[model samples]
Target chain A: MTMKIVFQKTSGLTDKPTHYCPGCTHGVIHRLVAEVLEEMGVLEDTVGVASVGCSVLSYEYFNCDMTQAAHGRAPAVATGVKRVLPDRMVFTYQGDGDLASIGISEVIHAAARGENITVIFVNNAIYGMTGGQMAPTSLIGQKTATTPYGRDVSVHGSPIKVCEMISVLDGAAYIERVSTHDVPHIQKAKKAIRRAFETQKRGGGFSMVEILSTCPTNWGLDPAESLEWVRDNMVPVYPLGVYKNKATGNL
Target chain B: MGKVLMKGNEVIAESAVHAGCKYFFGYPITPQSELVAYMARRLPEVGGLFLQAESEVAAINMVYGAASAGVRVMTSSSSPGFSLKQEGISYLAGAQLPAVIVNIARGGPGLGNIQPAQSDYFQVTKGGGHGDYHTPVLAPASLQEIVDLTKDAFDIADRYRTPVILLGDGMLGQMMEPVEFTEGTEIRKFAKPWATTGTLGDGPPRTITSLELDAESLEKRNWDLQQKFAVMKANEIRYETYLTEDADYIMVAFGTVARITMNAVNKAREAGVKVGLIRPISLWPFPEKPFLETRDRVKGYISVEMSAGQMVEDVRLVVEGHAQVDFFGRTGGIVPTQDEIFEKIMMAAGGVTV
Candidate 1:
C-alpha cells in the first residue's frame, strides 16, 4: 500500500507563482509555516502578521487569517491580538531589516515579557524586499548597495545577535536558529517551526525560530552560489542549533 | 436627574464600564490618570480587559486592536499624551473601527501646563489626526452629563463606525458632582465575525485592516465614510438652547466653558441684558442649524472659550458674516472667570448702554 498525504485547503495562500526570485528561500519557508499550521490542525485558528520588507505580500501567501503590520511592529500587533484572544494561534513573519532595526524594542519587550506568541524571523543578512539595502545583519565588510565597499563596524555598529539575546530572557521558553540549504537542514527547520507553534499553543511563553535564508537576487549571487554562501559565510556568523528548548515535544 | 457627589474622572471611567464597555487600554497621564486606575480595577471585575500599555501610542493601538476584535473599547489622556494617540485615532477612523477616546484638555503647544483649557476644540472637531476624516466629539459640562454622554458615545460611535471623543477639560476631570446609576441594562453583543477570536467553528476568519492600496476602492471606502458622517450630522446633532426666544444677544460655547457661559447668561438676564446661550452638545456636527436660525432675530454674537479663539472660527462660518462676531478667551492654563465673561457679554450687548 502507498502512504497518502493531504495539504490544508483552507489556507489563504494561492496557487499563483510566488513573487520571489527563482531558488529564493522565502517560498520554502512559507510552505513550511503553512504546513506546520496544517499539520497541527490550527489552520483556521491561526492569524499571521506580515512584515514591511520583502514579506509584505506574506498575507497573500498564507491561507489562514492575516494582517499586515508596520515595519518592526508585527510583534506588538500580535501581542495585541493574542492578549485579546489567548487561545488563538498568532505569529509574525518578519525579515532581518524589520526585526532588527526600527522594531527592535517591540520584539525585545514581547520576548522579555514571555508573551505566548511565535516569531518566524527570516534572517537573509541583507535587506531583500527593499532592493538589497544593507541590513542590521549585513556581515562586516559585506558588500551591498548601502555598504558599497563593506560593512564598516565603527560607523555601522556590529550585527545584532537577536536569538542569542532573546535566549537569555527569562520569558522566552524556546529559542533556536536553523538553516534551509538542504533537505536534512530543511527538515530540522520544520521541526523548529513546529516546536515554536506548539509551545505557544501549550500556554508556554515566547518562542522564536530564526531561519538563515538566502537572497540570491539581493546578494548578487547565482542561485547555487547563494545557497553556498548561506552554508559557508552565513553559517559561521549565525550557527544552526537549538539555542534553548524547554518544550521539545515530539518534534 | 439629581446630582450625586463623585470625582469627575472616576465617574467617567465607572460610567463607561457600567454602560457596558468591556475593554480599556491606557497609559498613565496626569489629571486623567484616575480614569485609567478606576478602569484597571473595575473592568476586570466585570470580566473585561484593562491593559496599562508601555506608552500612550501603544495604548491607543491596543484599543484599536480590541475595537477591531468587535469589543467596546476606550482610552483616555491629557493634552501631551493625547497628541501621541493621534496616529491610532487616524487609523481607527480609516478602518471605520468604533472606539471612545477621552481628551481631558490641558494647556499646550507642548506640555505647557496641567491646568484646564478648551484649546483642543479645533483639534477634536476638525480632523485632529490627518487625512480627510472627522470624529464625533461630545462636550460634557457636568459629572451627570459625563456619565450620560459617555454611554451615548458608544452607541453613536458604533452606529457611525467612527471614533467618538468625549472632550472634557482638566476642571471637568477633577471636579466632584452627584451622579445617578441606571438599573441593569442588557448590552447588545455585536460580534465582528471577521475577528481572530476563536470563532466557535465559524466559516472563515475575519480581518480588520485600514489598508486599501487600490485607488478606486480606497476612494469608495472614503466616500462611504463620508456618507455615514452625513447621516450622523443629520440625526445625532445635539445641543441646548436657553432663553433664545426674543433675546437681543446669544452666546455660543461648549464643554466646561459652556457651564461658565450659562452662569453669565443668568446674570445678564437679571441685570436686564437680554442675553441667551446655545450650548453645543455635539461639537463635530456643530449644531449649525440652531446658530443659523438665530441670525434673523438676535444682535451680534459673543464667543467665549479658554483658548485664544478656536471654535470661534466655526461659529463665524455658520454666521456667514451675517452678524458681528468677536472672541474673548484666556490661553495657556488661565481660566476665564464667569464675572469676566459677564462683563464681555454686557460690553458686546451695547457698549454698556447703562
Candidate 2:
C-alpha cells in the first residue's frame, strides 16, 4: 500500500502566504525548488541568492537561509557564498529582466568562471514587477507598457537566448532550458534542477536552468493561453532541452 | 595570527581572508591594484576563489554572486571604478547583502588622476549609489585601522546584512604601517543555513530577492534600512581629535590628508599659529557630533583635502554660520607639501605669516 506523504514546509520561504497572482507560474516554480530541496535533503546547508525583479521578496517565501542579491548579481553573490562555504549549496533565482539587462556582466562571468553554483533563472518574457516593460526576452513585435507599438528590432534588439549563449562557454558544466507549462515539462524541469544541484555537489562548474515561465497578468492572457503562448513563442527562440551537458550526450 | 607591517590595501585583502572570505572578484585599478594582486596570490593558497573580472561592473557583480551564497566576499577599486560599481552597490544595499567594498580613492569628476584624493567624500557618505540607503563606511586613517576595520566590516556586514565600505585613499593604499594580526582568534566559519548549497534536510529551497511590488512594502523595507543606519551611526561612529583646545582655527581632514594636516598643525603651533586638527576615522556618520560641539569654540575652520572643496561643504553645513570655514586642496594627481598647507593655515589665520 502506498503511504501518503504530506507536503513538507520549505525552509527558505516565509510563513506568510505568497503574493503571486492567480495562475502565475512563480508559485509552481517555488514549489519545484522546495520539492527538489526536500528530495536532496540539503535544505539545512542551502543558502539561496535572491535577485531583483518581481520575485524580490522571495526571501519571505523560503524557510532556509536566503540572501537577496542585486539584479543579475545573484550569480556573483552565489560565487561568494559557495567559495567561503565550499560545502554548502549556493543557488540564485533571477527573472529575465534582472538577468538580461543590468546583470548581464555578472551572469556571463559566473558561468565563464565555472563557479560551483546553480542558477535557477526564470524567464517570463515581460517585466512583471515593472508594469509590463519590454524585457530582454520579450518577443519581437510583442507589446509592452514601454513598447506601445510592437518591439522594434532596430531600436530595441531581439530576445536573448541565455541557454544557447551559456552553452558556448567551455567552463559551464551544465546548461539547460526547460518550461513549466505542462506536467511533462515540469518533470523535465525538476530533473534539470536535480542535475544542476548534483553538478555543484560534485564540484562541477557552473550550471543553469532557464525556466520558460508564465506571467499571465503581464502578458494579458489567461493562464492556459499564457502557457500556450510560451509553448508557441518562447520555445522557438529559447528551445527546451539540455543545451550542454558534461555528464551525458543526450536524453 | 601574528604581527606584521603592511600597506592599507594589503591589510584589507588579508583581513577578508582571515574573516573567512573565500571569494574575491576585482579588476586592476590604480592605487588599489595591489589589493587585487595580493588576493590573486593568496586566495588560491587558502582554496579560496579569486578572479580578475573584465571591468569594475563585472567585478562588483562577481562579488554580488559570491555574497549571495552567504560567503564573506570583497572587491576593491579606485574613484572611477567606484562610479561603475555604484549600480551593483545600490543593489547590494537594497537587498541587504553583506559584502565588503574597498575604495582606495583617487581624484575624479572624470578620468581625473591616479594620485590620492578624498574626493569621494559625498559619494561614500551620502550613498553615491541610487537608493534611499546607506553603506556603513569606515575610513581608516592608518594601516592598523585597515586591518581592524576590515574584520569589523565583515562582522557588522553579516550581523546587519548590509554592505560595508573601507574607504582609504591612494596614499594610505601605498603607505606602509605596522599591524598586529589577531593571534589565535579562530577563523570565523559562519554557518549560513539558507545558502544554496544543494537543498538538504527536510525543508524547501529558499530564494533571495530584493523585489517587493507593493509600494507600501518597499517603503517599509527602506524604512527598516534607515533604522539600521541609525543604529549603525549610534554604535559605529568613530573619530580622533588632536589639540582642539584653545585653538583659533581647526583643520578638518581624513585619511592621508588628515595625516598631512597634523604635521601642518604641529608646524603652525611651533610658529605660534595656535592651530588644531580634527581627523575623521569614520566618514559616514561623519563624526558630526564632536565637530558640532567644538564648533562654537573655534574661530575658523579649514578643510584640507586633495579634491577641490568637497569636505569643506560638509563642514560649512555643520558649522552653520558659527565660524569662518575655508578650503585648501590640490586637484588632479597633486599632493600639496607641508609648507603649502602651513601657508594656507596662516592665510586663513588673518594672513599672519608663521
Residue range with the least summed lDDT across 10 consecutive positions in model 2 chain B: B194-203
List, residue by residue over B62-170, the lDDT tens digit for candidate 1. Answer: 6766665567889999989998889878888987888999999899889878999889888899988878899999999989898889988998877767899998999
Clashes of each: 11, 52
lDDT of each: 0.85, 0.83
Predicted structure 2, TM vs. truth: 0.87
State which candidate has the highest TM-score: 1
Interface RMSD of 2: 4.0
Candidate 2 Cα outliers beyond 4 Å, as residue runs:
A1-17, B1-7, B15-23, B46-48, B61-72, B91-98, B148-162, B176-228, B289-293
Q: lDDT tens digits, residues B180-234, model 2?
A: 8775566555566644444555556555556666899999988998999999889
lDDT of 1: 0.85
Best by lDDT: 1
